[model samples]
Target: MSETIAPALLAPATSCGVFIIATPDRLAALQQLVAASGARLLGAVTPGNAAARLADQISLDLLLFDASSLAAGEAADVAIALAGSMAGRDCRIVTLLDVASIDAVAGPMFDAGATLLCNPSPTELAAALAGALAPGGTRLHDAAREREAERLRLLNEEVARLAEVLSQLAADPANGVRDRSSGYRGEPLAEPDPDPRAVRSTIRARRLRDQHFAPELFADPAWDMLLDLYAARLEGRRVSVSSLCIAAAVPPTTALRWIGTMHDAGLFGREPDPTDKRRAHITLTDRAAAAMRGYFRAAERAGLVPA
Candidate 1:
């Protein structure tokens, strides 16, 4: 592996500095992207040595890591190192990965609040770099870029709405969402927990819609993930971040964004794997679980099926 330090990096006062850790095959393209983003390419290093090298370069404004070529174990190590080293720093992180690498790499990256891209196009790469170096490069200069930005904006808005609703439903005692384990007002609720099979059947029905219609028309990552986690909770199973991403049936990046949003909204919580530090499982918070149960119970009472 070769490492190059651009001369511009020697004079940090002039340009935004970017450090890259990518595989040999992707190094050149990533360099080209960094250059195109108008950020100074501070240096390029291999994944194995990235953490040690990164620790020495504290002035870097961005860190770009491509984990597509790495084995799962190696990717996990690099992810953890990067997350630790960049904590509380002003630097932004952009991680490029494929579906295969997501299970190993997404957990740490998600924890670090890095932008994760799964098999993105060249345009997407350029846009991400520009977004990372925003305020100066935030103008939507093209139709495609504008559309993409609009999509992201809408996604955030929708998730925010869902989060607010979930919070309200779970907290409002009048909504019949009181603690199920203990009787509410010394009176036990007669409603039983929704059958896991019913939730699973709804999931299958949603997937079946893709067979006859455009899946994009009904791409609801927030709801899909909620149903999945609720069903898993009922089944006494744990859901890894990667497995939940798959359950979303959306792009991995999109799924991850929704997960992060929901987690921040207090609807989701992270549980570290007792056996594996590199992996973490995602779970619905007690509030979220209660809201889901209330929703199902409401649906049953209204003679409406769960969607």
Candidate 2:
């Protein structure tokens, strides 16, 4: 991330100092101050129009005016332009000079949208900048939105590429998740189909459900009973625990106990039907979706179709 997840702590709300037409010595001092208090020392604007270039390159949090060498009019003009560039920012403009320059530089600079700090030390300067630049809700949210937008752009390109490659296969049909590289590189041409028998277990039986094997899964009455009841309740539009029992031809008390066990195992949650206060429904948790996918894959292999 360009910005830090955990933000650097700036002190409570205050204005950031403006550095207008900073000298090398002034820049070094500000950098030291920034490091000390973990505040962004904002922009170091050059004299006149040149400050805009430096500001654009560096996303600083404050500015400072060096009045030690500049005329009052010169310093004030630069401060006004800098304020114009960062018009909405809470910038503090502190003029660095001997006490004589107070009348010469400080008042005009402040009047042009800068805050005056009288002879601030490095620590005080840093604290001032941090407090001024600490993010409010809008900046953080904008940063987050930018990050997500970049991620989605990359993901979309990757998916599109995969789709293109698959389309080139299957005679370029617009359907199916085809394997483009399959049936190539000198592979064998497979044999004829065998008649169905007890050995002909569905693909579901070969799938693993946790540590347990799938063929052995339905040996538990609760497992088979749940599946049959689930399908029936869905088909019959009776989407509730009581309906599941009736659909499965099982006793309500027994079915409820099994469902309770599954729910406790993090397999589902009970939600009231949106349009019916008298009834509630169980929805599969994500783990339960995996379980259902395995079951459906098996049914597909056995050529099972909805009645």
Candidate 3:
């Protein structure tokens, strides 16, 4: 059965109009949130009736699709519907997916510009809803958003610093800076690409450290993923979205967000799988690959093993 907030009780016209496709339990959980976000609940339907329900609505401002309990094929259908319905509009789509169904729907959901949350907790879901709703949306009155912004800012700074150093190394391989003050004098040799095994070994070493110490001490998803993709590139292996998330060594939601961020930053690129239309592979961009190569060459020249 489906339900909707009555038209007479709906919020003002400025309130976002939301349509949902989810199980009864999930629908029940989101009802309060939709209303709290100042988003009028236009309609709610089960996965089986998603297409029919969507067709009846003349317009929508947001589509909240929950695929956590769905099989891969059904989830893919929902993703396709989301993309098709909002093709040229400003409708915001937020999809909830579990680990099992992520590989099937992630590619299409990303292409549709939907915010993908993998097995999100209530807090995470609320944060995502608030962000999507924006100025009119209810605020959480917490520092979580601020903290995330600070973390992302730090991440970008680190990336920029590394890129600058690698660019210099690539541009002038023979020009080695002799830091007499630190007794450091080594020029990065323009050697052949580092062996894929060497990259894999470095990844293993990072993981091994987590066994002895706090994993959070070395929690750097961006660098971890870069190394993973670099190794895959060298080995000519395709990396699925799920695989990359594992390599990130963080929560699935965080990994997905980082993947999106990296993609937007041009550090990552997506390639559609030729054999599987429902799947996509993540790869380091040419620029990112060049930086990785420079890093490895520099490491070798300085007599330090790749880490």
lDDT top scorer: 3
In model 2, where do residues sit more than 4 Å from their true spots? 1-21, 40-45, 48-50, 54-60, 88-97, 134-307
Candidate 3 weakest ten by summed lDDT: 1-10
RMSD to the native, candidate 1?
6.4
Segments in model 1 whose C-alpha atoms lie over 4 Å from true places? 1-14, 136-191
Please estimate how well model 3 matches the true structure, expressed as its whole-model Cα lDDT.
0.79
lDDT of 1 by residue, 87-174 (tens): 9998889999888778778888888889888887776666667767654444335464355456556645654555565455445544
TM-score of each: 0.80, 0.31, 0.81
Residues 85-128, model 3: lDDT tens digits? 77887788899999998888888888788889998766667667
Candidate 2 scores a C-alpha RMSD against the true structure in Å of 24.9
Q: What is the descending lDDT order? A: 3, 1, 2
Better of 1 and 3 by lDDT: 3
CA displacement after TM-score superposition, residue 145 of candidate 2 (Å) = 36
Model 2 misses residue 202 by how many Å?
99
